[model samples]
Target: MPEDNHSTVTEFILTGFPGLHPEYQGLVSAVLFLVYVLTLTGNVTIVFLFATNRSLHKPMYYIILNLSICDILFSTTTLPKIISKYWFQSETISFTACFVQMYFVHYLGTVNSFILLLMAFDRYVAICHPLRYPIVLKKSTIQILSITAWVIAKTGPLMLVIRAYPLPYCASNIINHCYCDHIGITVLACTDRAPYGFPALVLAMFILLGSLAFIMFSYCSIIIAVLKIANVQGRIKTLSTCSTQLIIISLYYLPRCFVYLASNVGITFSPDLRIVIIMLYSLFPPMINPIIYCLRAKDMRESLWKQFNRRIFTQKAQVPSVSN
Candidate 1:
């Protein structure tokens, strides 16, 4: 607990993909950069599409917008630094910067999880309690809940960083990852046991298991309601709306739960495998989210096409006017 009882380790050396052949660095960098670009573009497009379309002003689209924003921040938190590390062979991150990175990464990730849960709740209410859905999920209520989620998600990491400040950083400050991950940072801690460990575990439970349970419960109820519907069209309509959400939730949660549980259980894998899983966790959801929403939500697709055709027609009309 003594603040001065530790070694003064200034920066952590990141051993990303250690012992990999140097020739593959460029290839890895290129692949990571491409994934980062796609993540950014896809999430930004979703945010823009939601923001511009007045028809998407409901609670569901609001949650989608928040989710997209969280995705943008989440990807930015880890991938850019990872790409830079591979591309430039720069692996050193200052303690302050590392903590900041970890904070935002957890914050955005937790917020994203909660937002998805809220989306599930929204869908559940719409499906199960159609009459009260609008009143239950008013604009003010959505805003309040969204802000609360962000605040709660951010609080744990921030406090953990503060608590861990007292722990000494000895000479061994090598982080075996491309970015500042919680486990990587903890591995570098010189103390016998990090003070942040328990809090981090609690946060992980809340973010992953708690959210997962909520989502599953909501979906279970949704499934039962859909089954009870007598009309085929009604059942199909409800099922279709929930299907994309189910797919996205599975993709986002399953890998995360696996990785997190594995790390906690001391089942250490190779750093390269770790990197691959982390990259998969970071990149895939963002890339797939827009695709799922656009493809599954008929209204979103129509809106996108409407906007696209409007632009094309505007350009064509402008050409004729210019010629005249």
Candidate 2:
């Protein structure tokens, strides 16, 4: 491909979910608005509880706080514009803005993946090596791990964004999905970007699959440890604690793997269904994460219940005791 001076495409028109009927766009947008609000409310409530409740300042809560933060950022990065696209019929996004959205979408996603890995590691240490968990995951150590996840996640998307930043887009300006993504945008580049994309894709897969593999290994060890318990009740209790994390891991990772495999394996699925699956994993996990990972914790539920009652009783009493 060659650079052309008079490229006509200066923006992209995102045809969100090609099969979504025109008449139902208003309903869809309304549902998305509710989903976005719920996602924010759930994740923010977790963050608030973690910050305010002294009892939650443990290794598990620390890692979970990062997950909540990542979920909020991920929802904010992707949802607003998609909502607007449907609600206001504003389907066109400028070229620069599209790539900007793409960058954050991938960046936050990568960060969340790492955070999940950290959670798995925390659970492993807690269950498999209970005695050393406290010493192994001190406050400073957890902080380091959280900061590393945020920092290291930027490498791949940064490289891809920088290389594609200057690429000429003359092929087409229509993004056939809900939002801009590296694959969708780069495919529009006039010149061959395989040289750049291959490496970036490799790095992304390394981060994704490597974290996934480690999490799986950690859980395997956790399973073995739980199994070694001779008492039936103890084994049941141990497995119950892990059940929530396993569900969240499956929610976050399985759909992603399916979407990736489908795209790469020449699966004969319909385009509409393919896009729907991608949208589901991308948006669904953040909305449900707080419910599954944070609220599912017994301590978290008790704290939330207490806080709710406290607010209700305080409001009923009409007391304004301000002490921030």
Candidate 3:
């Protein structure tokens, strides 16, 4: 075999939301900063609550805990550099670091899809097979599933990076997307991009649509089982629990499918517009997931209130004052 050619480009500049006006740069950075802060705060709070609260030590929240950690990691991997780009004008990422970022961006996303599938399975067992839910989805079982998701999510991303990273990048080093990804980087390669691009597209469709189909089937069964409950209150209560997951699932899957389908079917948007849509689906769910749990799930609300009251009481006790 001949020696592989080396890339000419040593660093890549991330052009976040390409064609973004100079006037709006600060505004976009501020908004993204707030989103990053909220994503971390919300997901971190969920993890804290799960760790400190014993009542949430169940299969459903265990899945949620996995998702929260994934969200935190995904946000951290993609946000800071873009925020720096728009705010502080620091945009260059080394060739090696760019691919490293690309790997996590794809890896964590695949992990999220798998975790959502696990969420659907948990709900399915709880509602469709209530008697066996505990037996089937114990903590140990959930831990194994979560571990498997994180491990397996690495395959597609690692393959993409391995195939793409070695290509001669003798072309432009400006990435038009907010973050480094398989498509954004591979398109710059000084070689035919079809081999790298096609596999990624197929893998993405498989992960998103395949998981989505199973989730839909699980919910359909859950709905059928829910309707059979003779008591109105029971049916309503069961649906209420499932509704939160539905909201999350819809937020995660629908926009993604639309974007991916639209891109392939000839419906086109400007690059900036497409990037904006991607960011919407990517960032919005993590920001609101914990809020959904608190507002929609009774147990989470009660636990949050308990934690809040405890903090207030501690603050009050710590205040030093002279008696009037």
Candidate 4:
């Protein structure tokens, strides 16, 4: 297992859901396909709505626009290939594409994590300091925060790739998960792996725990501010608005914290179960995000409905009546 042996592995076979029954593969593939379509269409609609509607344009929404884009790109990176793996039995991904997917998977994930934190910050400002919120989170300020998040999120994944890309992969070429990620790819390397894996674990913890702490602080401040509102109805209104983001934040962070803890720490679990959880957290948020927005954000839903009606009416008008 010399370091020079990395060249021997040109592609990796993805062994998706290793414990799934053979008879259930089709069912699983069909279900994943439906999820993939729904995730793509829903996120795409959100991004389009943000782009087209001036009413939807604002700092909070600009943050949401980033989240929507991340959801779409992240799902695109993962689902189609995984669906094809189960459907067509196509599991081989070229070496370059594998790393490319790995890069985006982590990169977009980091971006989404920060976007959620930004949204939390936005809500905190708007709720706890409504008077100064506009002054503090002006368009210029929001632009800088968005750009900073993107730039910061980019670095960790590049560090991972730089450390992992050089490792010799003489050990194995089969990934026991649905997607390429730091652990999945680096575990294939023949080296001691601690040098790669440990740093990644630290980075993952830093991202998840750090963001969670900030979000909690923001929410705590928001809570205190909400309690100070003289009108009970106003307090309830404010809390209700945060319901969607709260649920989404839970989905995004909770599973990840468990996965990292169980995997990196001393917890023992079956390999298949671990992989399933990994895929679950990664896939669940993006799939549910659009639904959360539509259910929680009335303005986005109304704008989308208007757009949908316009398209339908225009289509009906364009259609020629049957002469038969």
Angstrom error at residue 189, model 3? 0.6
Model 4, residue 133: displacement in angstroms? Answer: 1.0
Tell me the tens digit of each residue's lDDT in model 1 across 37-69: 887887787877787888888777778888888
| Cα shift from native, residue 60, model 2 (Å) | 1.0
Instruction: Please provide, for model 4 over 187-242, each residue's C-alpha lDDT reduced to its tens digit, 9 standing for 90 to 100.
Output: 88877888778889889779878899999999999899889989999999999878
What digit string (tens of lDDT, one per residue) describes model 2 on residues 68-156?
Answer: 88888878887788889998888999988988998998898899889889888888988998999879999889999999999988988
Model 2 misses residue 124 by how many Å?
Answer: 1.1
- Candidate 3 lDDT for residue 70: 95
TM-score, every prediction: 0.92, 0.93, 0.97, 0.92
Report per-prediction Cα RMSD to one decimal: 2.3, 3.6, 1.6, 2.3
The stretch of ten residues in a row with the least summed lDDT in candidate 3 is 1-10
Clashing pairs in 1: none
Clashes of 1: 0
Best by TM-score: 3
lDDT, candidate 3, 114-211, per-residue tens = 99999999999988888998899999999999999999999999998898888988879999999999999988888888877988899988998899
By lDDT, highest first, what's the ranking? 3, 4, 2, 1
Q: Any runs in candidate 1 off by more than 4 Å, and if so which?
A: 1-7, 260-268, 320-324
Candidate 3 residue spans exceeding 4 A from truth: 1-3
RMSD of 1: 2.3
